[model samples]
Target: MFDPTAFDNIKFMIQAEVYDRDLAGLFHVHSRKDLVDLATLSRESVITFSLKDSADLRVSLVVKADLEKLAGELLPSSNALPGVSLHILYFGTERSLMAERMDLLEWMWGTERRYERKKIDSDQTGTTYEWHVYFERIITEEMMDELGDLISFIGESLRTVTETE
Candidate 1:
């Protein structure tokens, strides 16, 4: 029998939730990548999407699991367990209100996650910003049920940050 890793399960759950929203007309799927590093024996998956009405802002959900995590789950004597780190990234040209938006995201994601914003590129016209929300702890299979709520919160965050204040 073949078994799926925690990373695989979580990635599928996230994709299903996002694609469901795409089908319902709330969001549009842009790009997706599922990669495995043969040398490191690590896995990473990224899914990018945008709000239905706004294509400028791109949101990406990334899930990654390294070899140590996978080995821990596969080996019965290992004390460590398998898990994936979840990161949500936003790309857009909204420099003026970035501070406020970061604050709003911090509040929405709470204190467990670390947030960072940096200018990825800039030109005379405007600057492109990338905001990343990194979940501090490893997300295991037990936390699978939170996938839907996480997607919902992300949607709420999109609305909150883009709205005129």
Candidate 2:
């Protein structure tokens, strides 16, 4: 059982042991293009994070988790355990009004093109983004089924290609 108290205490948790660095997801994107032209020509907001390697003995240096998918699996049940009201607080969506309000930010910058002129303002300098998610369930047989299926698939798929390799 996961301790709910840990959520209030820990701000972040480090993930460990990932096999492939080249692939970002179940899919792949392979190409290089102008960042600016892509932004104007495309809708995706690109961001990158470069991590410094750690030398700690306990750290093996790879992390992978599809929490977005996992959260989808952990939906709230209509009925919950007695005295344990399982709360699945999902944000990063319209349901989270406070989170949405906090994310309301306007970006300001000098426009190089006439098309972007009116939108750019000097006071605001960057885009705003908000995200939140939660998973909840009382210990139950049906809940175990969801977890079992997810575990079985991951274990079978990311396993060895060759025996004893």
Candidate 3:
């Protein structure tokens, strides 16, 4: 019998929530990837989706657990905590909306998470802006129930972004 790691459990839960939304016609999943690095023994899951009402802005949810976190979960003597990092990515082309996005993010997630905007050069759009939402602390299994709320926030955030644009 193989016991799943904490990262696997959380990833599955997140997928279930996102897929349910997709099935409900609220969101359209764009891409999904579950990756494992053999050399580093790290695990990562990335899922991107767009709101059914607006495909212009896409939201990506990323979950990651490094080797230390995995070892801490599986080994009893390991001192490292079994914590996973969560990130929300927003993709858009309007740089002028930076202030609005910042306000929306602050209103949705407060000041707990860090935010960063990066500029990407593109042919289709003069420049694309990618917003990253990073959790200040790694998430543990104890906070699993909050995952659904996180998904809901993403959905609402997408809708808000579309309405403003």
In order of appearance, the predictions have TM-scores of 0.91, 0.17, 0.92
Best-fitting candidate, scored by TM-score: 3
Kindly list the per-residue Cα lDDT of model 1 for residues 56-93, writing each as its tens digit. 77899999999889988899888877899888998887
Which parts of model 2 are misplaced by more than 4 Å?
Answer: 1-14, 17-125, 136-165
- lDDT values for all models: 0.86, 0.22, 0.86
Model 3 lDDT-worst window of ten: 93-102
Q: In model 1, which range of ten residues has the least summed lDDT?
A: 93-102
Candidate 2 weakest ten by summed lDDT: 54-63
Q: List, residue by residue over 27-92, the lDDT tens digit for candidate 2.
A: 112221122233332211111111112111011111112223223334454232321111111112
| Global Cα lDDT for candidate 3 | 0.86
By TM-score, highest first, what's the ranking? 3, 1, 2
Question: What's the C-alpha lDDT at position 74 in model 1?
Answer: 91
Stretches off by above 4 angstroms in model 3 are 95-98, 123-126
TM-score of 2: 0.17
Q: Which residue pairs in candidate 2 collide?
A: 108-124
